[model samples]
Target: MEPTNEDYTYRAGDIVYVFYRNPHTQDVANIQEAAVVNNPENPNELAVFLYETYYPLTNEMAVYSTEEEAEQAYHHYFGGI
Candidate 1:
């Protein structure tokens, strides 16, 4: 199924920045670039390719279209580093 939010939609090949926390190191969180692509399990849905994994794209994900925007959000949420 598609994302519940109607205001945002990502197409295949779109580059988005997301605030990601390292799975192995829970203390490390940073902004990372991800590629939007069709979900392998569901062609009609979109997913983000990052950290060598595929994640479903939803409104809940801290996704931004540009690095500057992502940085601003990162600083706002993380406060530093």
Candidate 2:
């Protein structure tokens, strides 16, 4: 599980930040900026588009509304900037 903004409500066109791990370099990770959009397969659900992929939006994801917030969280969790 990952940290989430309990008070935040997801909406389409919103920009979000998330921790994205490199597929080829499993040990490397970075904060990625993503866009919130309605799920193409399920309009009622929300998804995030990042790295040419669509990930379902859920509380289990560490989602941040601002870059500062995501950076703080990344530092706290990974202990690096």
Candidate 3:
């Protein structure tokens, strides 16, 4: 039930939360898909090409199992109606 990398589309100005598996941590970041390099040498992956809101940080993008979970996290971190 986990969201696959293909499920999410990187958009400019889209706020995202990344989750690292090794240490198990969450990071809020912004999407800069436009600046991402998609080439043979530099393979383009959604999780790897993201702009971290907090510098000097390393965490892979979290994949929520459902849209509700993602929305809840987004609301909790960014506030919502």
Candidate 4:
């Protein structure tokens, strides 16, 4: 068995590589969720939440600025993701 999309688990702030479908093509984006500012709650988790404007619209993954920044983004975006 392979990892399905549903297998991805996201946390508050973590940098991720998101693969999404563009208008007529496939695109990949780097995103970072607002949650994992510092260290992730679960380091073992594959996916994590991010707050990059491009992520939402493009369905790309989150790329973290910094551990602290990621955390701050999480709180700012989701009010404490």
Candidate 5:
């Protein structure tokens, strides 16, 4: 998923991770993980926009290609998500 801030650590083409919600329970039980990859065929805006748009309900703290990096960034901002 995309980071809320424009100047974020993650970028297009990165394997963004998002902990999506369980629609049924509305809880943080489900994971809406996805890769925010940029497709050359589409516009840059459209490519990046999909990441966040797809998982709007996710309590996404941070996004990175690697799990290790993701955790660090996630907690750094959210303190613990």
Candidate 6:
């Protein structure tokens, strides 16, 4: 199915694509999507389900505002895989 334009935010329940950097991986940079599940236990950190690790929603990496952008970014990174 095609994706629709939607404004994404850091608020809980919003779907977003988070960019990660790993030296061990094939690509130094990677992108993944997860729902915004804020860690109420700690406001200093951001959390999301289905993610390998808990990363802060900071400016160090990219965060696509919508699923459409995420899909395009994924395809671009994975060579349209």
Q: Which candidate is the best by TM-score?
A: 2
TM-score per prediction, in order, is 0.86, 0.91, 0.28, 0.26, 0.41, 0.52
Q: 1 or 6: which has the higher lDDT?
A: 1
Candidate 5 per-residue lDDT, tens place, 1-81, comes to 443433454556555555444567773433335755454454333133333453221223434455666566656755765
Per-residue lDDT over 1-81 for candidate 3, one digit per residue giving the tens place of the 0 to 100 score: 222343555432334444332234444432122222233232333223333322221124454434466667656766741
Model 4 C-alpha lDDT per residue in residues 1-81, reported as the tens digit of each score: 211233343443444443222445444222222432322443433333344332231124444435565556556764663
lDDT of 6: 0.59
Query: On TM-score, who's better, 1 or 2?
Result: 2
Candidate 1 regions off by >4 Å?
Answer: 1-7
Residue by residue across 1-81, what tens digits does model 2's lDDT show?
222356798788999999999999998889999999888988878899998888999888889999999999999998986
Best by lDDT: 2
Q: What is the C-alpha lDDT of each candidate?
A: 0.83, 0.87, 0.37, 0.38, 0.47, 0.59
Better-scoring candidate (lDDT), 2 or 3: 2
Ranking by TM-score: 2, 1, 6, 5, 3, 4
By lDDT, rank the candidates, best first. Answer: 2, 1, 6, 5, 4, 3
Candidate no. 1 TM-score: 0.86
Instruction: Work out candidate 1's RMSD over C-alphas.
Output: 2.1
**lDDT digits (tens) for residues 1-81 of candidate 6:** 112224334666677775555657746555667766565667655666544555555444457866677668877876753
lDDT of 1 at 50: 94
Where does candidate 2 have its weakest 10-residue lDDT segment?
A: 1-10
Comparing candidate 1 with candidate 2, which one achieves the higher lDDT? 2
lDDT per residue for candidate 1 within 1-81, as digits (tens), equals: 555323666788989888889889998899998999888988888999997789988887778888998899888888965
C-alpha RMSD for every candidate: 2.1, 3.6, 9.0, 13.2, 6.5, 6.8
Model 1: colliding residue pairs: none
Worst ten-residue run, lDDT, model 6? 1-10
